[model samples]
Target: MGNGDNCNPNWKDASFSYYKYVPSLAAAGIFTGFFFLAFAGHSFRMIKARAWFLIEVLGFAGRAVSANQEPGCWTQPPYLVQTLFILLAPALFAASVYMTLGRIIEVVDGEKYAIIKRRWLTKIFVCGDIVCFLLLGGGGGMLASAKTNKSAFDLGNNIIIGGLVLQLLWFGLFVVITLLFHRRMMLSPTARSYQPDIKWRSYLHALYVASALIIVRNIFRLIEYCQGSNGYLMTTEVFVYCLDALPMFLVVAWFLWKYPGEISGLLRRKELYDGSMHEI
Candidate 1:
């Protein structure tokens, strides 16, 4: 693969190199399988989480297909498919994590302990997640389609960085809120928090683990984009798998092992008990 002309005419004059090496089909396959497993695990219980996992499945599948193509010989469609899907998939994962924290707060009846009201916690964070999603997806599309226009490519990279920075800020705020709630709950536990059936603390711990991994991944990406296409991070295929792929897979696996369905079940039971009390 000599650096002469790209197979796609659109990228013929583009300075950007899509991949430094052939993308690893094995890596893509493994990650895709893990995501599918997570999706199946959550499908019957946590429908919303399952939806996000489904998108991850599609993203890694696209990556696998893109990997099969030789570098510098990629067509426009495959390039866009891989770039856009892989770049945007983590945002969806973040959305699920945000909702999990909201569910945890509800399960513990820790509304007063939380910095943000339980009713608004998911809404605020998920809305921020949506904005990050659009910024990332739109920026990725721009980067992929910029073609021969160097200025356009730079612009796209800048947009992606902006999105990443915003995501980091939101994640930081989320962690602070979770810690504050955890501290308050410990100092003055709610009645529900004492219930043997409610494992809210364990769930909060899981949220911390998940959120930390995401924050690390986002920081890696922010650095990668800031370093530009020819930077070491982009030139090395190993970093993507180790930093982005592995961490994200662990996140899904963690959620599967510590499923949020328990919280949902507890909430349902609480609603039923309250209804019965009202009738009495």
Candidate 2:
């Protein structure tokens, strides 16, 4: 259509009106950080036990980015702190994930989870996560560069599909594996301390919610990508806000405070949560 405008692809089309709502958005970021902190913190035990913790953390970190919205909303005071929370979120989520998986493999022995122990699976996971991280990072960079050059949007929009697909695939596989584990456990009665399929499904449901939010926001990139190369996707500020910023924050907090660890000691008992065949 018209010539591309200069702005970061990250903020989408957030403009002067975006400024009007900056305070409100920043406030929401504060609440989101606190709410997620509990999820992130309380998940420590599960993180320790599971090999896929990094994937979970990155999923949440992406949500935290949604919470940040834009710098216009976080110019000063509490907003700055909130902004820091938003900015630092993805990295922390990544670190937590890395640490969680590494800890599980190291402490319990990687062989414990045969599925995870597969060299092929590990390679696939590592590659997929790297791609997913790069895609999200590219989006963030484009958003930042949007403050300067208009062309960076091209790279940002292009990388998203590959990343989203890989991320979603990994998450789907994760849900399936968890579901299978639950089904097996259900067939046996010895798993008294194990987290029932309910709790496992509940956690998976929460993770899916987070992934779905990011997936929705990322879809804007695809729309922009399809508009013809070198097209500016951020120009559609209305749709971006409605689809990406607004709805992306609608993650359910109900399960955060009441999960396997807090509600049941399943996360606390590593072997119990391991498999249906027997406790690890």
By lDDT, who's the top model here? 1
* Clashing residue pairs for model 2: 7-146, 8-146, 8-147, 10-143, 54-97
How badly does each model clash, as a count of residue pairs? 0, 5
What is the Cα-based lDDT of residue 232 in candidate 2?
53
Could you tell me how far off, in angstroms, the CA of residue 83 lies in candidate 1 after the best superposition?
2.0
> How many clashes show up in model 2?
5
| Model 2 TM-score on a 0 to 1 scale | 0.48
Off by over 4 Å in 1: 1-14, 44-52
lDDT of 2 by residue, 119-227 (tens): 4444555566666776756664454444334466456545555555556566557545544544543454233324243243455454455555555654554465456
TM-score of 1: 0.90
TM-score of each: 0.90, 0.48
Q: What do the candidate models score in CA lDDT, each in turn?
A: 0.81, 0.42
The weakest ten consecutive residues by lDDT in model 2 span: 15-24
lDDT of 2 at 207: 47
